[model samples]
Target chain A: MSWELTAADLPDLARGATLLGTGGGGDPYIGSKLVERVLGDGAITVLDPDELPDDAFVIPTAQMGAPTVMIEKIPAGTEPVLALRTLEEHLGRTADATMPIECGGINSMIPFVVAAETGLPVVDADGMGRAFPELSMETFAVYGVHGSPLALAGERGERVIIDTGDDDRQMERLARAVTIRLGGVGHIAEYAMSGADVKRTAVPRTISMALALGRAIRVAREQKRSPFEAIADTLAPTLYSHVRELFVGKVVDVDRRTTEGFARGLARIAPLDGGDELEIAFQNENLTARRGGELLAIVPDLICVVDHETAEPITTEGLRYGQRVRVLGISTPDLMRTPEALAAFGPAAFGLDETFRPVESR
Target chain B: MSWELTAADLPDLARGATLLGTGGGGDPYIGSKLVERVLGDGAITVLDPDELPDDAFVIPTAQMGAPTVMIEKIPAGTEPVLALRTLEEHLGRTADATMPIECGGINSMIPFVVAAETGLPVVDADGMGRAFPELSMETFAVYGVHGSPLALAGERGERVIIDTGDDDRQMERLARAVTIRLGGVGHIAEYAMSGADVKRTAVPRTISMALALGRAIRVAREQKRSPFEAIADTLAPTLYSHVRELFVGKVVDVDRRTTEGFARGLARIAPLDGGDELEIAFQNENLTARRGGELLAIVPDLICVVDHETAEPITTEGLRYGQRVRVLGISTPDLMRTPEALAAFGPAAFGLDETFRPVESR
Candidate 1:
């Protein structure tokens, strides 16, 4: 299915993206403003992957770095277009369509801004069904998409094009360092692929799915119903399986430090009624959720923290003590459950001792 | 004058470059070995800047990062050529000549290695007559050469090409971050200029000057004469004027740390015969020399530390407490004494309170 995304769709899109963000990908506020500014009278055309011509070149773009820094140093509003233009110049061809590298947080809105600015249709698909901390954790990488010949742009028109005979992990290391140098955040355009590869590798219809999820939350709030039940029902029939409420608690503590270009820390949430406390550890994005040493949900699964009363999602950087929140668990898609995907984004991949057991199994 | 650099010249070249290094540019051992390995039967043809065609593309290459890291993580013998090739590819033309960005320590030998490997003639000139810590301190930059459209390559075959609307300082910030990410050292080919710019801005005959200084020290050692005197005499007739012994003492204390991609610290030297102790501060290269708050030598004046007995120059990273050494002060070249040059490399530029006083004035 295809549709034109108008300004009215932005609120739901941003809200839904934050839910999928799982507490990372930066605050969607700046991204929302940027999209709203560029998207004035221009509407973004959303094309399903199958609708694109097989030979058309599809380029994925996103911002990479710390969310804390992004909140302070707003982009000069030129990086995304510059990054896209540079990549196109390097490739000697205009991108037939633009797509988000991931469907979470600010990244989900970035492609729309680029699409509106450049007059290019955005693909309905994304490299990741939900956010993963590192660039190599994308399903596109698992399916053999090289990350280099990548173009990165800073706020001041500083542009760098990298080509490395390195694996995705090395690419991430190099790009992360570049991001830190560019003042802790940079816009990047990578993983240029043909439409056929997009259909085969990407998580399709994630844009539409996020929109539907956002609409459900809005409807639930209007009807005075539980947003948690609304979200679980909204995700039940989708690619994400096994939706459930993990915990309802007040955040007791949050220990986070920005290191090596990532916000890494652990959050302790005490049960609102005084039962066992739940702890969630994160490196940019939520990695594992546990209660008293028993794993509730681990990486390769989704662990989202939302406001207890309003169901508004709080990013990792936005999480603070004393906030009452409800943590929701949702199983990742089958594409991310494969052995290669697990090896790249599983609990063990993040230094956790337990082998990854799907959220559905729990 | 034109000459061929041979294996027989490596020792003198390395030794002279070290003296000119003014306690930075990294250790020359690896560079010596690299040049030796690459220059086996092939000789490096050295050309005076004036002899080159006006339109000929001259590329200056060097390694940028912390000197301490260079001692442990040696390069994989491919970075210079790779950096050159990548730049050539980006510019769509082969470099007509290769030259050192500075005639200090390892950089002095890097061009020779590239020349031997690529069969391009090595220019007998450099951007700096002696070493200065940052990229903007180069004479080329002082004379209006942009450091961009620059290419950097790492040991792991990671290559990056940067083009910025940024000045040289911003370029250094970006490249330094890239070097640190590439395992603390990266070979960069930048400041691509025409032969006319080379003649107008470069420090001419620096390679030959280094060789003569090295030969003088070698001769002084053989004849049991003071190597310090020979070095002063050798530099007296060159662009560098007013050489004198600043202090002769044993190292009392040394404090250093690798921060922001540079080895920054200070060394305190106390007189063995009980006069006044001298203190020298450095950031990769020695920045100032003072005795009890009395300024003796400051950048862009060259401050070098050499073994008191053997007269062998020691870089900042090689300095250790308890080593007996002599500090020498030498005047910077006229090219580096200009208002623009001093603004970029003088004492005040390094955060010193006093205005720059040429070594000759002292």
Candidate 2:
């Protein structure tokens, strides 16, 4: 299936991307504004992996670094184009299309910006169904897709092309170091893949899913219905079928400090009526969620916090004390829960002690 | 004029390079071992910049990161070749010859190692007449030579190519960050230049100067003559004409720490009997030397410490307490003392309060 995504669709897409970002991907409002500024009246053609030829080259682009910094120092709306062009020059081939490397507030929108500028359509899929902090955490990497030759472009037009030769960990390490020096934000084009590779490794139709998710929330709000129920209904037929409202509480503590090009910290939410507190730990994206020391969702599962009334997703950098919110534990797709995927991005990968317990299993 | 650098000549070359290294540029022993392991029976042809055609492509190569870490984690002797090959691939052309980026214990010898392996002649010139801590502090950079596309290769075959356009400072920052992640040391090939650029910016005949200085010391030691006087005599007719014995003292204190991919510290020496102590500050290369409160020598000028009896140069990483030493202040070449060159590697560039004063003027 294919779709045309115009400027009017960005708000809905952003809202849904924020939900899928797992509390860290950069601010959705900023992502929407960047796309709107560049997109104008143009419509981006979004295609499914199956719609492209097997030989079609797909380059995934995203912004890397601390989201906390990104909100203050927004991208110049040109970094993604620079990163894509740099990668193309390094590869000596033009990209057939661009795709999101992961689902997140900014990352999901960055590809569209690149597409608008390059006149290249965007693939409807992504490497990660939901966001993970490091580049190697993607399903593409776990499935043996190379992360280099990776290209990074800063706001100042500085470009760095890294070729680590199958060392994905080194790619993440080197990219993060450069991102810090590039003022804690840099746009990257990496994991250049053929359509076959995308079909094999990418989460299918994630862009459509985000759009549908956002539309569901908006329709629920317009109809004066419960947005949480709308979310459950929207995800019921999707890959993320097991969705649970883990807690309804007010944020009591947020211990976040952006460092090492990442927004790393913890947030605690206590039930307003009095119950065990809910706690979430994150490194860019939420990694683990627990209620009263019992695990509710551990990565590679989605743990998202949203505004209690409007169901607006709250990113990690936006978490604050004394905010009433609803925490959701959404099951990731089976593809992202395989043994290989867990090894790449499970709780242990993020330095958490507990083993991965899926949201539905818990 | 041209010369042949055989394996047997490395010892003298290393000795002279250490003296010119100004307490940094990696350890001479390690550099010698690396070249010896790769050189085998083949001799490296050394050519002056003028010997090559104006359009000849010359790539300067050196080891980056802390010299202390380099001694502990020696290169695999193939890193330089890998670096050079990576750069060649990036440029889409083969290099005509290789040259040292700076004068240092290991840096001056690294180009020889590359030359021996690549069958390319080593240029008898370098960007920095003496070692400086940062990459941009080079005569080539000062006089406007692009430092990219620069290639870095680690022992494990990790390769990174940085293209910062004309922003050399960003190049240094990003490269240093990557070097730190490359286990505190990496091999680098940078400042891809034409023969014309080399002639216009590089300090000419520095390799020949190093060889002569090293041979002078060895001959003086063999003849039971004062090696220090031999040094003075050797440099008298060269670009580094003004030579002064700054101090004769016993080391009393050394405050050194290896951090951020650099060996930074301060050393204090007192006259054997009594008198005002001499304090030398260094970040990889010695930056400033002060006696009591008076500046004896500063950066952009050579400040070397040698063994009291043997007159062998002592590197900053090799500094110890209670060692008898003689400090020498040698003038840098006129090219290095130019206003532009001074602004690049001057005392203030290293965050020193004192201004640069020529050794001859003092």
Looking at model 1, residue B69 earns an lDDT score of 93
Task: Report the C-alpha lDDT of model 2 over B124-161, residue by residue, as the tens digit.
Answer: 99988877778888889989997978899988888888
Q: Which candidate has the top score in lDDT?
A: 2
What is the TM-score of candidate 1? 0.97
- DockQ each candidate and list the results: 0.78, 0.82
The per-candidate count of clashes, in order, stands at 1, 1
Clashing pairs in 1: A23-A316
What is the Cα-based lDDT of residue A245 in candidate 2? Answer: 84
* Per-prediction TM-score: 0.97, 0.99
Question: What lDDT does each candidate get?
Answer: 0.88, 0.89
Lowest-scoring 10 consecutive residues by lDDT in candidate 2 chain A? A26-35
**Fraction of native contacts (fnat) of each candidate:** 0.93, 0.76
After the best TM-score superposition of candidate 2, give how far the Cα of residue B34 lies from its true spot, in angstroms.
1.4
